[model samples]
Target: MTISMNCKRFAILLIAVATLGCGNQNDIGPTGRVNGVLTNKGVILSPHTQVVFLHSQGGTAAYGGTDEKGNFAIDSFNDGNIPIGAYRVMIQPPESQLGAEDEPSAEELLENSNGRKAQKKDAEFAFKYRQLSTSGLEFEVKEGENVFQIDLK
Candidate 1:
C-alpha cells in the first residue's frame, strides 16, 4: 500500500511539472506576420485607413490600421500574427458613410419630421475597394514575415 501511494504521488508530480513546463497552449495555430503600405496610383494614402483580411475559409477575419504614412500590420486571434492562408483584402477610408459622424444622431433623427435624409457625397476615390468581393485584392500569407505594397487604382 505504501509503495503504491508513493508511485501515485510521483506520477502526479511528474505530470504537474510537465504541464507547468509546457505552459499555456491557447495560441491559434500556424500564423504569420504581415505588413504593408496603401497607395492610390503611386500616391501614398494619408487618411486613417483600416485593412481587413477576410480568410477564404469564411471565419474570423484579421485586420489592421494605417498611420499617416498608410503603413499597417495585420493582427488576428488577439496576437500580432495572422493565420497562414489566402485572404480577400478590404480597404476602408477614414470618412466612410458608415462612420459615426456620418450617421445622424438619434435626437437629430427624432427631431426631423421627414426622418433622416440619406446624404450622398462624391467619393474621392474608387470606393469599390471597401468591399472584399469587389476589391479585387487578394493576398496569401505564408509562415513568417510578409511585406505587401498595395496600390489602388
Candidate 2:
C-alpha cells in the first residue's frame, strides 16, 4: 500500500510538471511599437484610412487607422505593439461620401425600415492597396520602436 501511494503521488507530480511546460508562450513573444506616415504621390492619405499589417507567417494581423495627417500606429493582440516578423502592408482608403450617403440613417437602422439596398460605391483608392496579396508593400517589425515613412505612387 505504501509503494502504491508513493507511485500515485509521483505520477501526479510528473503530470503537473508536463502541463506547466506546455503553457502558451506565443503571447509572450517579442514585440515592438510601429508608427509612421503614409503618403500618396507626396500627399498625406485622407483621415480614417484603414491600415493593416498581415503577418507573413499567417496569424492575427496588426491594424491601425490614419489620422487626417496620415499618421498611424500598428496594434496587435489587443495591444499597441506588433510581434517581431515580416508583414505585408495593406491600406484601405476612407469611405466616400456617396457610400456614406447611401447608408441607412440611424432611425432607419433602428427601425429596420430600409430593406436591402444597392451596394455602396467603392472608394477611388479602395482596390489600389486594400489587398495584402496585391499591395506589394512589405516591412519588418523588430524588438524596439519602429518608424517608417511609406510612399505610394
Candidate 3:
C-alpha cells in the first residue's frame, strides 16, 4: 500500500509539470508575425504592390511592396486585444507601378493636385482595390504566426 501511494504521487507530479510546460510553450510574445508570398498563377510579381490586413471591426494593418522574389512579412505587437473574428486581406498595386499598361496612370490621378492641398478621400483608399484579381482574402489570426499565400487568378 505504501509503494502504491508513492507511485500515484510521482505520476501526479509528472502530469503537473507537463501541463505547466505545455501552457508556457504557447505563451509567446504579444507580437504576432505574418509572412507569405503573393502570386498569380505560377509567375511571381515584378513591380511593387501594397498589402493591407483589415479587421472585421474596421481596424487595419498594412504591409508594403515585396521584393522581386515576391515575399513579405508584417510583424505587429498588440496588447492581446484583438477580438476573435474574420479579417480581410487586401492587395493594391502601387499607382506608380502596375502589371498592365491599360491601368490608369498615377500622374493622371494627381493631375489636379497643387502638391499641398488635400484630395477627396475616404475609407475607399484604406480598402482600395487595384484590380479584380488583387482583392484581399479573409483569415482568422490566432496567437501565433499567421501565414497567407495569395493566389489571384
Candidate 4:
C-alpha cells in the first residue's frame, strides 16, 4: 500500500513539473529574429557579398556581410518589418564575374569601370520563390526568431 502511494505521489509530482515546463513553450520568441550563415554547396561565401531582404510589398532591406565565423543576424526586422508574406532574399558579389579570377587588387576591384562591372549593368539576377533567377532565394518569414540557413546554389 505504501509503495503504491509513493508511486502515485511521484506521478503527480511529475505531472505538475511537466505541466509547468510546457506552460510557455509557445512563448519562446515574440518578435522573430533571423540568424543564419550563407553557403553555396559546401563553400562559404565571401564577406564582400551583400544580402538583401525583399519585402512582399516591394521594398528591400540590405545587410552587408557576415562575420569571419559566417554568422549573420537580422534581429532588427523581427517584428514583421516586411509583413507576413512571401519574400525573396538576394546575395550578390560586388560585381558578377564572367570567368575565373586571378586575384585582382582591391583598388581595381573597387572601381566601377574595372573589368566586367560595366558589362554587368544589364545582367539580371534575382530569384523568386515561384519562378527562378540567379540573384535571389525565396523564404517565408514566420512569427518569432527564425534561423534561416541559405544555400545560394
Candidate 5:
C-alpha cells in the first residue's frame, strides 16, 4: 500500500514539472499574437487558404492557414508568437489550384523554360496574391496581440 502511494506521488510530481516547463504566452518577449481574417471584396476566402508573412529585411517569416470563415491566427511553432517586423504578405491557394502563370510544383517553379501552361480558375475572375514581391500587401506587426482584417484586391 505504501509503495503504491509513493508511485502515485512520484507521477504527480513528474506531471507538474512537465506542465511548468511548457511555458506561457507572457514569457515570449518581443513577439506578438497576430489574428486576422482574409477577405476579398468583403467576402470570406476559400477554406484551407494559406497566408505567408515574409520579413522585408529577411531572416524571419510567419505562416497561417485560414478556415471557412476566413479567420486565421499566426503563431511560431504552434505555441510561440511571431517576432515584430514589417512583412510582405502572400495569401495563396493549394498546389492543385496554382495553375500555369505561377508555375507548377517546387521543381517547376524553379525552372524557367516555360512561362504559363494551364489556365487558373481565378486567373481573371478573381485576384490571387501569390508572389512575395508582387503581393503589394504590406503589414507591420508590433508587440502584444495584433489584429487586422486583410482585404485582398
Candidate 6:
C-alpha cells in the first residue's frame, strides 16, 4: 500500500514539473531565440560561412554566421528573434563574397587595376547546403531559447 502511494505521488510531481512553462506550449508567442553550431559529420565548421533559416511558411529568413568557434545565432531583418515555426536551413559563403554589393578592398582594387590577380580565400565547407531545397536540414523554433546542434553530411 505504501509503495503504491509513493509511486502515485512521484508521477503527479513529475507531471506538475513538466507543465511549468509560462503558458501553453502551442502558444509560442511571436518569436523564438534560435542559435546553434554548424557541424560536418562530427567536426565543427568554423570557417566564414553564413547560415540561413528560411521560414517554412514563406514569410522571412533569419540569417547569421558562426564565430571563430563555430557558434551561430540567427536574427531576422528587423533585428528581432526568429518567428516561431519550422524553417529550412542553408549554409553558404558569407556576405562579403556575394560581390557587387560588397566593396572590394583598396589593395584588391589596385591589384585588379594593375592586372595582378587578387588572392582569393574560400570558405572551408565543401558539402552542398548552399541551397534551401538541397540542404535537407530543417528545424522548428519554439518559444524561449532554442539551441540546435545541426550536424550535416
Which candidate leads the pack in TM-score?
2
* Candidate with the larger TM-score of 1 and 3: 1
| Residues forming the 10-long window of minimal summed lDDT in candidate 6 | 118-127
Off by over 4 Å in 6: 1-29, 95-123
Cα displacement (Å) at residue 111, model 6: 33
lDDT digits (tens) for residues 1-153 of candidate 4? 999999999999999998778566334232344668877664665554555666555453534456555566653343323344456676655344323342345665678564643232332232231122545477777765567787655
Cα lDDT of model 5 by residue, 1-153, tens digit: 999999999999999988887678454347777888998878887776778887776457778888889998875663647777888888878555555564445565456466643334454214437777667888898988889898876
Local accuracy of candidate 6 as per-residue lDDT tens digits, 100-144: 423346778686877644444453454357778778889988877
Lowest-lDDT window of 10 residues in candidate 4?
123-132
TM-score of each: 0.64, 0.67, 0.49, 0.47, 0.63, 0.59
Q: Score residue 46 of candidate 6 by CA lDDT.
A: 58
Please report the TM-score between candidate 5 and the true structure: 0.63
lDDT of each: 0.77, 0.76, 0.58, 0.54, 0.73, 0.75
Model 4's lDDT to the true fold?
A: 0.54
Top-lDDT structure, candidate number: 1
Q: Give the C-alpha miss distance for residue 153 in model 5, angstroms.
A: 1.5
Per residue, candidate 1 scores C-alpha lDDT tens digits across 6-32 of 999999999999978766555556878
Q: Sort the candidates on lDDT, descending order.
A: 1, 2, 6, 5, 3, 4
Report the number of clashing residue pairs per model: 0, 0, 1, 5, 0, 0
Candidate 1 weakest ten by summed lDDT = 116-125
Model 3 misplacement above 4 A: 1-31, 75-85, 98-136
Candidate 2 ranges with C-alpha deviation above 4 Å: 1-21, 26-28, 95-126
